[model samples]
Target chain A: MTFTINAEISQFQGKLYKLSHESTSTKTPMDVNVFVPPSSNSKIPVLVYLSGLTCTPNNATEKSFLQYFATKYGFAVVFPDTSPRGAKIEGEDDSWDFGTGAGFYVDATTDPWSKNYNMYSYVHDELPKALAKEFLQLDFENISITGHSMGGFGALSGFLKNPGKYRSVSAFAPISNPSTCQWGEKNFTNYLGNNKEDWYKYDPTHLIADYKHENQPKILIHQGSKDGFYYKDHQLQPEIFVKAAEESGYKGGVDLRVAEGYDHSYFFISSFIEDHAKHHAKYLGLIE
Target chain B: MTFTINAEISQFQGKLYKLSHESTSTKTPMDVNVFVPPSSNSKIPVLVYLSGLTCTPNNATEKSFLQYFATKYGFAVVFPDTSPRGAKIEGEDDSWDFGTGAGFYVDATTDPWSKNYNMYSYVHDELPKALAKEFLQLDFENISITGHSMGGFGALSGFLKNPGKYRSVSAFAPISNPSTCQWGEKNFTNYLGNNKEDWYKYDPTHLIADYKHENQPKILIHQGSKDGFYYKDHQLQPEIFVKAAEESGYKGGVDLRVAEGYDHSYFFISSFIEDHAKHHAKYLGLIE
Candidate 1:
């Protein structure tokens, strides 16, 4: 078996399968959780959920409350781990923000990290292919992407870069303009080198500016007003992506909602998960 | 403030307040998380959730998906920690089954444990009083109690002993005949001494046998058939209580639904949470 079933838990009207498989991109075993709705038959649209920094497949799998929505909409939800596990690189486990659990969803171009920190290809390409091959019921073509924080940035940047690849994109408190953020600057400097151009390639704000939508490409985003990362540190500037979208061909396509009293946590994500699910369901043609 | 608000995150018309407070029962600062549902104007009913072994308050707070139901029903939910934390007893953290996270919800009568392991008093009395005094909007008088595994035993034992105290009681994969179960017998011997009578007092099977119904008390329980603890170890003898209920005045009052393909994890609890919430809501008079 290419994928190992670590645990299978029955939840809602579905079963949550915790799986691990050797990844060619990361060159290590990666853990991922896939929730298949109970009544799912034939081909079901996939909704890939990416987690934030200092998270694993379990964080969103346990916290996001996605299974209920998945079961309701008849879509398979996949939770991919944030980064490669047990890489053993120097200073990897030192900080909660930069290394280990914080992959930032970029294919690292620097040494040590470059060898195993290829979460971009792992999540964007390898994971979907692996899942499709393993589970024939999953429709990768009709997939939608959604995430929180760094994972949220992954969804936006991955969606913008690969046009028409995903049916829809949604995020919760995403690091919109990652190139300028402290988290991004440190991670980019370490993983993608000092080249600002490399960082721009992965920045959602930058990507949205050049993105040419076939129709007015609608991207949904819910940011918590009380998010410490957004308000205190000014790390997650969601308005930048909204502004970029306005200037681009996708003008007025972004639906950025600022949720009051919410924070940069799973509580905030779980609150708006149903709305995001509905948004993706509409785009995936699960709902009209 | 004796009770420090560690983090307050907004979710689904509610705010999850992670609080740590000085405990009079446990004699240790205890951590708790309370979910105050949105749009609550008048004093609303409360649901106190007790987690199982090797769990913190965050387990159910994150995974149980109770907040949605609480918000829907206009009720507040409180998730108390499994046990007194950081007690630092000699053999406290030695085993996953006892000590540390597994306080077993007992007011210990032995040795070092007796000093800090008074979880029964902490959860049933002090915690509720503290929460009621602290949050004006919470009506502890109208509170329902529910738990899973060891905490489920807590709910049954607590509810049975304190007649007319709670509006209702429910459990998921609870150790019904804990006095006979190894997990129960071991913890009982350690906490309540070697007296079998002392252990029986805390056992639901024994309690239900002698329980005097006030207008016919009803208790809802959902036990998973695939639960390893129930099948393999025989640690959770739910049938014993059901049999006892059949002989007692609480006959047909104990609704024990054996769910298929579900385990003893939060997944099982979350799967039936809506049903449990509705069950609680009916007794709490939040629903018709």
Candidate 2:
């Protein structure tokens, strides 16, 4: 994990830094942006944000609605690019919903992609190592993950499969049952081989279908009723996951909020970002 | 006037529409975004927002910190592009600080640009005509103008010269004395041709020096002390205008606020946009 600090600026008493690194998981170069709260007296909780398709690290880190709440609550934020760059590997820059900008946050096992597309390991393993060593003297025990759209899938799959890694988890219109959704089905077949069992490890409902957490961390989910993808084979059908959690005795740590007349747009996110920030702040004990 | 709607979306209980039309003054086509409040009952106060150089109606309408405040206060907002487009005129789009997006809100009188670069007339006359015909129910009598950077120059110049057009005027780091600034000097020389007297109509400081308003509307200005251009050769020097106003026994209708350690960026504007919006709201009696 060799890294270098690209740039740093003081904002609202906190310091935001741009970082670049050479990763072993992705086997390519990557860029990330981080914001550390001014309260340096103690270790702070961390939140990793994953952006949706056709987005780079800049989208969430630059235009995100999380910084205000993060600054107030004294939590740190880590934003990594969706996929590796400069490699120009086969089919990296293909479709808007797949390839380069859309890594789907999964470790690619298929040929041509498996070479440099391993976002799961980059985010789960390499990213934590770099952030923990370089940025904050933060409590790794209280870190959480949250995201939107494809990033939402990343949050659910990342935290559910690696339960002990993240203390809590939440998402803004995530892909709950990816195996059944068009986006999930396409990416899964390409990244995780044809075996159905391999796909279960990355689906939140499947991971929680037979497991129960005695001390389950709080989980929050927001879905937009007017989202275009809700109909047909979309990833966000909260009922499936809710029934699974109930039948499996998942201990009721989940909160699902549906916003009416909202679409898949930044306007929708900005409207309720304050609420999401407050949710993370309260759970992290950064604010009352 | 023939008119067409570009893009529209429902928001804040009203409709926001982007409109386009051919202009009599500017000759070239012009585009503007107008947001009508949630009421069809009575005409509401209008707030015209002029954007800076290198900006179109799109920048302020999409990215500015005004929409939330306008929605909260129940006021209409109209944003006009800084200059005429598709002129195919020479010397346009030459510099970052001048031409194309930098109309300086003045009707050109010289060269190939003189034919289609009449921004002053387009904004003050043609734009108003289109608005009256299209938005017949809007309260034109309670109109106010506010802007930033070059558009600030436009706001101050337009309101002061027109006398009774706007009930209130304000700016965010406007180029106050454009006649004495490099940006103004160069553009005026090219657009108006060596006639200093003709340039007076387009300079806010010059207008204030010659005219006095007994019941002048309140003018508010927010400038960042750390702004790189404040003290530079071509800058909006607030102290000079303050001295002139004091000498003229002007009852301080203009309020100048200098924020410490801030720069000339959207961050600074977003920090204090609510205050400006409230100021206009107070004058319009939209909110108590």
What tens digits encode model 2's per-residue C-alpha lDDT throughout B97-160? 7678887789889887788878888887778777977787788778888999888889988888
Off-target runs (Cα >4 Å) in candidate 1 are B87-89
Misplaced by over 4 Å in model 2 are: A1-15, A36-46, A61-64, A69-76, A137-141, A164-168, A214-219, A231-260, B1-3, B10-15, B36-41, B132-138, B215-218, B231-236, B253-255
lDDT for each candidate structure? 0.90, 0.78
Kindly give the stretch of ten consecutive residues in candidate 2 chain B with the minimal lDDT sum.
B7-16
- Residue-by-residue lDDT tens digits, candidate 1, B64-117: 999999998888999999988888789999989999999999899999799999
How far out, in Å, is residue B21 in model 2? 3.1
In model 1, pairs of residues that clash are: none
Give the lDDT of residue A249 in candidate 2: 74
DockQ for every prediction shown: 0.80, 0.25
Per-residue lDDT of candidate 2, residues A54-94 (tens digit)? 77877765455466567778888888888777667766667
**What TM-score does chain A reach in every model?**
0.98, 0.94
DockQ of 2: 0.25
